[model samples]
Target: MGEPSVDNMFSTASNKPHSRRKRMLSNVYSKSHIMANEALKAQISTIIYDRFLPYLASTFDDTPPTTTTEQPQTQPGGGGVFNICALLSATTMDIVTGYIFGLNASSNLIDNREELAWFLDLYNSRRSFNFWPQEFPRFTAFVERWMPGYRLSPKWVDEANGEIEKWTADMCERADAQVSSAGAVGGEEKAECVPVVYQQLWKALSKEAKGEEESGGTLSQQLRMSLASEVLDHLAAGFDTSGITLTYIVHELSQHPDIQSRLQKELLTLSPRLVPSSAPAAIPDPKAVDALPVLHAVIWETLRLHSAIPGPQPRFTPAQGCRLGPEEKSYYVPGGVRVSASAGLLHLNEEVYERASEWRPERWLDMDRLDVEKKKDMESRWFWAFGSGGRMCIGSHLAVYQMKYIVAALYSNYSTTIVDDTDIEQSDAYTAPPKSDKLMIKLIKAYT
Candidate 1:
């Protein structure tokens, strides 16, 4: 509520200052940079190939059942099923944090399940509480101040938030140390230590520092908190939304095992395949993964159907009054009114997407069958998984890269089958996940 720019995700923060922030680090997040960055590739390889694969393979005691397609040398976990939702959440955190804080300071949640549980408990369990503070902050604060023991946020929530803050702060300090050391850590180690975003933002903002402000002054504190807030918000949004989308991908693919196998074939075609491995592995070029039509279609379909933030993204009307709706039925609406477009509704338009309710990745790939304009409308107009315009989800590209890689690595090694999916229909809210918050899935290794 306080520093709304890019820091406070909710507020319809202005574009001028937001642009400044974007300029500082947009290159760091660009497709070219991400694809070419050797450090990022190594970080991803370590987290995914080395850590996630080993952890997943260890979840089973018995060999996996062969698929209906009869894929050979498959190993499935006959042992008790694990929560794919939580596992993927941990995976997202590790990957996102590695990219954010550098590999040295990033989370190892994949290897450390207990801490993953604790962090998710602190982060996920508190979603419902956000409605009060986010929607009706003024009224909520008034009630809490006037009435004794009538706090909207429970004491434990404050404590939980403090823990999250502490966790984020520690990462911030470590990233600071890494970037301060500059090129001291050379070779593969240097790549792992590059605090990409942190270093960029610090340098950009440092140019503005007059060096007159004392330690912890309004300028210093605000600057520090702003960076922390931006990174942490990105951290939460990056992991949670991408994780939920990926969970849905696996769920949809599990239900349609044929689709899973089709995807697996596409994934295995890459030069540096993401095979099941405990040893260090090479990460394929981001372009290679992005170029896979099947993979792209599946990711798009999942986002269309299961957008993490399908809710209307609130936008304030311009001060100059604007026309509303189509030209034929347009009306002049006064400025300052809050307006929004919902991806949930936009995506379900029957005209834009045939059998829109259905999970069909072919619609995206079946472009030749569609008229050019129709295809354009579907891909550009109807699709709003990452929102639209200048203030769109800043981490959209990063999310897509992470998701594609994660999905690629996953399907390349193992085929997932739904063990138990109670209440898989997503929770209806700002950042939706499964209502049950658990998509129990069993994994089986699939040999190429």
Candidate 2:
């Protein structure tokens, strides 16, 4: 098919009430929805920090070496094989699932080779094929089934959805089993559960299934499946974005020794270091961590420089078209036209930023330097890290929290200097990572 016509691309079914599912999906893109999601995310994040990190640290033997002075010996000729993308992807997914299903049902893919491989295969394929389905959902769904090479045909989408449904159902079944076993024994021994979210979801489904509420009567099997689909979307989105962001942060820190040193100094100010084992079992209180300005700024700068999903955030022009640009000069984009603005492009706009192309954290430090009008512009339209308006990232707050902890933990315990800086440039994928698999950094332990 030729490029979709402007009319075809932006066509809204005239006079038809928008479908509720469509409205729900649209809400996912809104700012209010994102803020509400952050609260759920924070609860899940605590589990990740308290339980998941320890498990990963132990599995990877990521313990800092005993001595600060000595460098850990490397295997010769085996440089740059560290697949930072895989590490970050697995880490993010594990954390996200922990939040979604509770710790009991969360994935342990970080150390589980087979699971990790399956996940990456699915994830990579989905990312590569997303644009087609998103752009022409109805047509793509039809053609994909019969088409070859573009393997995300209708059959593939069905299979993917089925797998996700089965996975979520299994979690629900397991929770039910635990609840039943506990009930049998006078309900005295509560099973070590994942989180309350899954249990709550299970109860809701059970009530709906029993036809206990008339308003929920229409929400039966298909509805449950749709909810499952949304959950999967959330998990997939949370994982990939966080993973890619962390990969870039690591690359940047490896390149900047002085910045790394200063970050380490800030981390040391935490009463007990932010090291994996140093903290209490739970993550430090979100409020307390959020208060650290330096930690917040470092994460913010890294996010600004290397937004994980840098592609255009697609939004269709409203019917009757809309005005954009400085003078509100009407461009007359046809209704149903797919138009978007990229954070990658916006973040690097030379007008709003000095040395826009340079990776300077100091730009973030001096907000006052810019003239008041420029600062207003920057505040209003410049920063698009988490995105702006209603459709921003839902788990952005939790992502920030995870990134800070990861950065703090790494820098506070070890000093990193780049081993192969040339290969550190990002690839051209939707979720970019270092072009070279290895982000070889020599780590020197830090002592306060």
Candidate 3:
């Protein structure tokens, strides 16, 4: 929320400016585009097969701790015990960055633990200080400037932010080079490595900025920063939210092995099963994976129960004001008043979702069995994970696409059991992550 510029769609408060910016690249993140983009498909396949799976496989060599004390022991086979939450974060980071900047230019976090740990440390450490700056920007600024002895946010926060900005700016530069170059990188692998989101926005902005040099528009500098800001927002939100959801999916599935088994069976039905092979794994068609009801239910239920952004999303009332509450209790709200909703509370409505406190994926699967009104309520009315209406998440389709594929690929081969869930509770932040930021799990091969 401590945004440096309001040019990014997320930070742009006014409807007109946000909508205009959203219009430029909304189609790229559309469901149809995400499902059918060959470049995206290739990018997913490369990440899952070449990076994520291999990293999981490398965990086989690890020796898990056996006791709370000094003694350590090896399991019968080997130690595939590792922090899957961190791995999921890394994978999502890679996927989002690849989609934004191209596979060739993206972070290799999945295969590079040192960098992953470093980046995660920098990113996650800033969470505790967010409240001061995000919720009280003016007071935070005043304290930092007038009362330097009592800085609201630490100096290192700025350093961490600077590093992240520089990192994103570097990717933007690489993407710009990719755009300005005469021809594409020559190779079968790099052929499908096009920066889909970046290219679309870059082309649109360039056309919009055309012939502005005569007017002293300074289009180049402004355009570069604007693009970087937007894409950086996209990358951060895309990775963090999806990673949190996927981690919970694995946790819930591990606790309910029967459901996990059912999911695995469905995953096996894919023509090219997402299993490890001597040859590159044939990543299943995302459409096929999407159609699996149980898989869909798992994802939906996880999203419902463990909404990444469970905090208030504030919106101002219309200038003309509007009615509030049920018909019996309806009252007129004053114009220009700030109002908000929380997905966490909305999803827990017992009337909308029976056993609302439970993690029952079957609730999503059996929605059609409910009464007409109940089914409607369950389907879309109560589902606010991605928010609703004009300003809803533009990356929802892409998020679902990557998550489905990642889940399908992982569960198709290994069965997960929680190694430790000491502090696995969801945090109370605006964008909630696991309290401990760790979910260690042991992955056993479903077959051998």
- Whole-model lDDT per candidate: 0.78, 0.57, 0.83
For model 1, state the Cα shift of residue 214 in Å: 19
What are the TM-scores, per candidate, against the unseen true structure? 0.89, 0.73, 0.91
RMSD of each: 5.4, 7.3, 4.0
Strongest candidate by lDDT: 3
How far is 126's C-alpha from truth in model 3 (Å)? 0.4
Model 3 regions lying over 4 Å from their true place = 1-6, 62-78, 138-150, 184-189, 211-219, 278-280
* Candidate 1 steric clashes: 1
Q: What is the lDDT of candidate 3?
A: 0.83
Candidate with maximal TM-score: 3
Candidate 2 colliding pairs? 10-336, 29-391, 30-390, 31-390, 80-438, 102-195, 103-194, 104-194, 144-153, 145-154
- If ranked by lDDT, best first, what sequence of candidates would result? 3, 1, 2
Question: Model 2: which ten-residue window has the lowest total lDDT?
Answer: 1-10
Which stretches of candidate 2 lie above 4 Å from their native place? Answer: 1-82, 144-169, 172-219, 276-283, 328-330, 366-376, 421-424, 435-438
Ten consecutive residues with minimal summed lDDT in candidate 3?
Answer: 65-74
Residue-by-residue lDDT tens digits, candidate 1, 186-210? 3335677677777666666665575
lDDT of 2 at 98: 59
- Evaluate residue 66 in candidate 1 and report its C-alpha lDDT on the 0 to 100 scale: 30
- What tens digits encode model 2's per-residue C-alpha lDDT throughout 93-211? 76666555654566766556466767666556544455566667777757755765564444575566456557656654554454344341343432224333333443454464574
**What TM-score quantifies how close candidate 1 is to the native fold?**
0.89
Candidate number with the higher TM-score (2 or 3): 3
